[model samples]
Target: MNPILQARNDMLGQMEQMRELSAAPIRPAAQIDGAVAEAGVGNAFEDALRAVDAQQHQASAAMAAVDSGQSDDLAGAMIESQKASVSFSALLQVRNKLSSAFDEIMSMPL
Candidate 1:
């Protein structure tokens, strides 16, 4: 196969791994489980938002590093940044669709 395509595939694989790592369910760490009975919606939403923000920040930083000649692997950085962009865009779409569904639901007759 072509080198660029192979590289892209590798980058995609890495992104998948990172996503899995990030989204792994909280295994109820012993102490926290004992302390809190239920995880609140606000906290979970906040955490998810924070994770996406962090990914965006990291992607930006990586791109900057590549631009400034501070990094060696241009392909890797570009791939990561692209992955971040795709992930954020997907998230935005999902949010929009959810909002639309919610609005539709609210408009339904009782």
Candidate 2:
């Protein structure tokens, strides 16, 4: 596997392991499949929004700490801020493309 894919799988495994340690029950594969079938793209978009919000909150907290002299990690704050920016940009692009596609389909002659 490519490095990126390998790293993602590794991260997922670690997350599952953490959940197991914490006693948070992992969803069964069949239940997860059913939930996805029900919510589809909407659930995925909600997850993305939440992830971006969490990143923004984290960046804000990091910057606050730096400003208050509670923490000196300027580089970590900057990285968090950039990650939030990039995720928002990607979501915006996806929305624009979907909008364009919908418009095109509506404008097509029957």
Q: Model 2 TM-score?
A: 0.64
Q: Model 2 lDDT vs. the true structure?
A: 0.79
Which segments of model 2 are wrong by more than 4 Å?
1-37
Pick by TM-score: which candidate is best? 2
Using Cα atoms with residue i matched to residue i, what is each candidate's TM-score against the true structure?
Answer: 0.62, 0.64
**Candidate 2 lDDT, 12-87, residue by residue in tens:** 9999988886796667656756754545677777787888888889888988998999987777677667778898
Q: Which stretches of model 1 miss by more than 4 angstroms?
A: 1-43
Q: lDDT per residue, candidate 1, 9-37, as tens digits? A: 88799999999978977666555566755
Model 1, TM vs. native: 0.62
